[model samples]
Target: MAHPLIDELTDSSFDELISTAEVPVLVDFWAEWCGPCKAIAPILEEIADEHNGQLKIAKVDVDSNQKLALRHQVMSIPTLILFQGGEATKRLVGAKSKRDLLADLAEVISN
Candidate 1:
C-alpha cells in the first residue's frame, strides 16, 4: 500500500504535479505485478517522510498511464525519475537501498 506521504499520480495530473511543484518530484513508474516496484515502495515512503519539503514522492501506475510511461521511456518497472525545474534530472532503473537513494538524490537535488 502507498503511504500517506506518497501521492498517486495519473497522466492528467502528472504535468501539474511535476512542473508546478515547489520541490523536486520523484516519480515512480510502477505496475501492480512488479515485484521490484513493491520492493522500492518502502524506500520511497521513507524518503517522502524524511525529505518532506525538500522532495515530493509520487507514483504512476504504468498499466494505467501508458501514455505517460511511454513518454518517459519507462521500459522497466520501478523506474524512479527526479523532476526539477520541469525536467528529468536523475533516473534510477530498479530497486535500491535507502542509503544509495539518499546519496544519489543528494547529488541531483543539491545541484
Candidate 2:
C-alpha cells in the first residue's frame, strides 16, 4: 500500500473491518484495468494522510474481490463508499479531484 493508513480489504475481512471500525471507513472499489482507478490512487493516499486519525481508508480490488464488489453494488470502477456505523452513508462514483472527493465525503463524514 502507498499509504500506511490504508487497509487492503478482501471478502473475508470486509465485514469485520467495517463492523468493528472505530471511525468512518472509506472503501474504494477498483480494478487494475481501470484508468480512473489508477488516477485516484494518489488522491486517496493524500486524503488518508490528511485525515489520519479522523477516518480510515480501505481498498478492495474488484478483480480479486468480485463477491465483495457485487455485495456493495459497485457498478463502476473508482467507487468510493463511506461507511459509518457499519452502514454506507455516502458513495461517490468515478475518479474526481482530491478537493471534490473530500467535499463529497465531508457531507457524511465530518471533515
Candidate 3:
C-alpha cells in the first residue's frame, strides 16, 4: 500500500489539514533537488498507505512553499514532522528507515 502525497500546502489549507484532521498527520518537508528527500519518499508513502485511515500523510515542498517551512524552522531536507491535534508532536530529520519511522510514530500515537 502507498499513501497519497501532497506536494503543496497553503497557510489556510495547511492549518485545516493538520489542525482538523481526525487522525495523526505526518508532514514530510522535502524538495525535488534533495537526494535524501527522494530516498525516503517511498518509505513515507508505504507508511501512509499502511497506516491508511489511522493517519494522514502529507508532503510539503520547501522550495515552492517557503512560509510553512520557515514557520516550522526547517533548515534541512527530509524533515518529518508528526502533528496531532494541529500541534507538532515530534520531528525527525534526515532519511530514516521504515522500522525506525514506524517506531517513532507508534510511540506518539500510542501516547
Candidate 4:
C-alpha cells in the first residue's frame, strides 16, 4: 500500500502540486507492471515518513497519466524526479537503496 503522505498525481494535479509546493517535491514516475517501481516503493514510503515536513512525495502512474510521463521525459519505470522551485532539480532512474535515496534528498531538503 502507498503511504498516506504520498499524493497520487494525475495530469491535472501534477502541475499544480509541483508548482505550488513550498518544499522539494519528489515525484515517482511508475507503472503498475513495472517491477523496479514496485521494489522502490517501500523505500520511497520510508523517505516520505522520515522527511515528512522537509519534502513532499508524489507518485504518477505512467499508465494513467501518459501525458505527464511524456512531459517529464520518463523513458523508464521507477524514475524519481526531485522538483525544487517548480523545476526538476534531480532525476534518478531505476530502483535505489534507501541510503542512496536519502543521500540524494539530503542536499535538496536542507536548502
Maximum-TM-score candidate: 4
Q: How far does residue 95 in candidate 2 sit from its true spot (Å)?
A: 0.6
TM-score of every candidate: 0.93, 0.94, 0.88, 0.94
Clashes of each: 0, 0, 0, 0
- What tens digits encode model 4's per-residue C-alpha lDDT throughout 1-111? 657999999999998999999999999999889998989988888888888899999999999999999999999989999999999999998898988888777886653
Q: Which runs of model 1 end up more than 4 angstroms from their true locations?
A: 108-111
Candidate 1 has an lDDT of: 0.88
lDDT of 1 by residue, 1-111 (tens): 558888899989999988899988999999999998889888888788878888999999999999999999999888999999899988989888888888889854442
Which one wins by lDDT: 1 or 4? 4
> Which candidate has the highest lDDT of all?
4
Spell out the clash pairs found in candidate 4.
Answer: none
Superposed by TM-score, candidate 1 places the C-alpha of residue 54 at a distance from the truth, in angstroms, of 0.4
Model 2 spans with C-alpha error above 4 angstroms? 108-111
Cα lDDT for residue 15, candidate 2: 97
Model 2 clash pairs are: none
User: What TM-score number comes out for model 4?
Assistant: 0.94
Clashing pairs in 1: none
